[model samples]
Target: MRFSWLLLLPLLAACNSNPSAERGEPGFGAADPESPADATALPAPDTASTKAVSAVSDTLRTVRQKHNFSNPKGPADLFKLVYRGPSILDGTGEFTITNPTGEVIFREMLTEPDLEAALVYEMKNPTATRAERETYVLRRIDRFFVPSQFHTPAIDPNAAFPTGLETLERATWDDLQHRPDAIGFDYLKGKEDRQRIAWSPLTKQVVRVQ
Candidate 1:
């Protein structure tokens, strides 16, 4: 875990930090699951999803999916995702990571806008339909936490790091140069919003690199 801090530091510079849309913070700015703009063009569900629903009344869209990062130091399936809404096109996503024993160490929220903003590449045509957009977002969630998504020593040691790190982040960044095995969770909120999270054994918790 000590190495994890080192790994995530470099990611701070690489990812976007929206003052109003941070993951751990409340709202995630996802006011309405189905935006009026999107719903106007989208049709009603032909059938409800078979996935088990939580206590909430809103549609439990993307069923909680457990992802095993399988670190080199050996923790299997550390991350889990629980989402609610009709679908990601208009959903709220809960991102959490736990230790081997299933104790949650980190948690955050992402709304449709937060996740959808990054899909501009897929929806290049401003007029793409709701169905087409949903297909793309769903695929993003499916492949979110695979091994290929995690980075070993998330920051390339040889690459120049960002210059604005705070005291603790700077220390972690400096230490990461030697920890080739340090693993960092990596994903994107949108095209410019790449997120990389790492664990810190010293802090006994996970810290957002930025």
Candidate 2:
């Protein structure tokens, strides 16, 4: 009688093939919720603002910034980061980034408070009309994907990471700082809170640069 181990091959293979065995790795946390719950359309922030528009799952606006934000050698406007749904402040919104072939690589809820920075200009003039304030957000969104808003070196040595990023985040920030061709998205979150987001070749996903 001979003892053989070949009988265990199929059992071992079956365990390896089980889908449940797969698990997601840990990633750095973000300040904002990556996915925002859909909220009912609220009255415009200002009483003098335009009448609230009814909420519907419709395309509000789409902006394709003419820049190679997704890839280093890619042509201009290779990626279209669309601003969908109604204006961030008026209704629940979403920001989705699509590749050249129209495949969405990144998707995130666009919260209203993020665009509140646009209201600062109107605050300057106590009598600023509602239309003028609305225009400010429109212009801010239009320029959201402009070339000027995309920085080559995502991370700045002098820039402060007020959020106190973790080890994984610091690694990603350092990684972007070294890549000269890597482009990052720069936008205002609060009054003057500038946020930097970029597609990390290493992470194979979009990450907030410190």
lDDT of each: 0.65, 0.62
> Model 2: per-residue lDDT, tens digit, 1-210?
134567777889978663532432233332222334323333446767677554444446556655666676875434343444544447434566666666666676655556655576557665657677566666666766666778876766566553554534666666677787787877776577776778888887788774
Clashing pairs in 1: 68-77, 118-190, 118-191
* lDDT value for model 2: 0.62
Candidate 2, residue 37: the lDDT equals: 33
Q: What is the per-residue lDDT of model 1 for residues 25-67, given as tens digits with 9 covering 90 to 100?
A: 4466643546687577678776665676664766454434444
Clashing pairs in 2: none
Best by lDDT: 1
Off by over 4 Å in 2: 1-57, 75-89, 156-163, 166-168
TM-score of each: 0.62, 0.58
Report the error of model 2 at residue 15, Å: 66
